[model samples]
Target: MKEIWNLAISPQVLPLTLLLVPVALYWLLNLLGTLDLDFLDVDIDADGPDGGDSSGGHWFHGALRFVNATDVPLMFVLTVLVILLWACTMIGNVWFDASQSGLTGGLIMGVSLVASVVMTRYVVAPLKPFFRMLRADDEKHPPVVGRTGLVRTAWVDERTGQVEIEMQGAPLLLNAKVATGTLSLPKNTEVIVIAHDADTGIYIVRSISDSIPPQSL
Candidate 1:
């Protein structure tokens, strides 16, 4: 335990260790109901350029996109990335017996950052899907095709996801999924119910962008 503690705070891995504290705090607060984290699970939007300084505004968008953060929340992506980087650095430091203030440590840090991003981009792919499910009480699902809905989870892919459909009363939450070939849809994406599977009880959906006429799901 002491050796592990010492390595965690060592200079080579200190930055990632520090970054993890806030992430841990966020999860704790979320579980305690002290924070509304749903809003934080939002995707990056580059609908149009922010005019003041086009490059300045666009740079942030590009960076996130480069990291493939279009389908997941920025915080979610960062949290996973920080953990991966921390792991990579710790392993590298132990393997190399790297000194905190030297070039070897810097190299390990650099490699960890790149490796973490690449690994994280792939790691999040599974979480990006839309899922199909039926309500526990109901045996036969109702027809909701052509209805409009908004993505409610972090992302919607071919396998699993959630969408909320507004009605006269409270909104309805549906088990949403995309067709096998369809790309994953990010949170808050307006979608149109495209199809449904009776056997599976999963609703298939597509983004409103695919059927754009006045822009709505």
Candidate 2:
């Protein structure tokens, strides 16, 4: 235990070890109800390209693609990556006895960091289906019926999608579905927040056209 403790705080492994501290803190605060994940959400501009600061939006968009963060919780992906990184760095340091921070230590840390990203992808892949089942509830969402929002997913249909609504406060990203008999709404397609399904907490939306009109809850 003492040896492992010394290794964890060693120069090469220490950076990732320190990162795990905040990850633990975030989860602790969440469990205690002092904070929640949304407070830490990096709002991905999902409403196609014209949504927000183009550069910042593209950067996060790129990152999500790089990490394959879709259909799964973001922090879960981050947590897995952080833990994997720490393990890889620690193992590399221990195997090479490179804990004293030299060329070998730096190389171990760098290689581990790159390898961890690849490792994290495969590590999280099998867990995607499980995490997809754990959708966040929308009980606290304000009434958004009759409001308008932009489709934020590649497209929205009966089974899956998201939309960004510009309501009173900051824009709210709501899980959305298109009306039956309606074609899929593509990303950035303006649609009316027609109805809210209280039972399932999904919003039913329809494309803004001459045919369909605003709806109530």
Candidate 3:
């Protein structure tokens, strides 16, 4: 334990060790219920430019695309990466007496960073399906399809809207848009979900009356 502690605080790996502290704290906070971390699971734009476009103006977009490839929360990926880096540094320090100062130490640190990024990026892919399942439960499951909900937006058409449905004694709010050829629904109107798009988490809905107009009665 003493040897492990000494290596963790060594300058070669100190930065990753420092980052791990806060991540561990956040995990503890989550367990204590003081922090609800569901927001961290929200999806980002992964379809953005992969390598720059014609103008080379997609640097930020490209960065996001690369980071989002794992489909897991960025915090989770960072936590895994820091742990890996810390372990690598500890092993190197003990077995090889790796440098802890000067140019050699800087090079070691640089390599650790790049290696951690590449390792985490690929390591998290196989685990993405599991993370996505968790995300779905937190944000969009229990099969709200075919259920009735009220339009929460001023108007709901192919381009825009929202709906609120009662589920498990709480409100389940969802993004909603009418199917093609369906008329728009106004606020407070009743609608039923006809389909759900898992990729976008949007529900395709139609006015309740559209299925059974008053004239039919």
Candidate with top TM-score is: 2
Backbone clashes in candidate 3 total 0
The segments of candidate 2 whose C-alpha lies over 4 angstroms from its true place after superposition are 37-42, 46-56, 97-99, 136-148, 151-162, 165-172, 175-217
Candidate 1 lDDT by residue in tens digits, 75-163: 77788899999999889888886455568888889998999989998887665442112132332435578989898765667866668
> lDDT, candidate 2, residue 78?
88
Q: Higher TM-score: candidate 1 or 2?
A: 2
CA RMSD of each candidate after superposition: 7.8, 6.8, 9.1
Highest lDDT scorer: 2
Query: Candidate 3 at residue 11, lDDT?
Result: 79
Candidate 2 local distance difference test against the native: 0.74
Clashing pairs in 1: 129-157, 130-157, 130-159, 130-160, 130-161, 131-159, 131-160, 131-161
* Candidate 3 TM-score versus the reference: 0.55
| lDDT for 158 (candidate 1) | 82
Q: Write the per-residue lDDT of candidate 3 for residues 64-156, one digit (tens) a residue.
A: 335554256777776777887777666766655554554565666677677776777777777777765665677744888889989865556
**What is the alpha-carbon lDDT of model 3 when measured against the actual structure?**
0.68
Worst 10 residues of 1 by lDDT: 130-139
Summed backbone clashes in each candidate are: 8, 0, 0
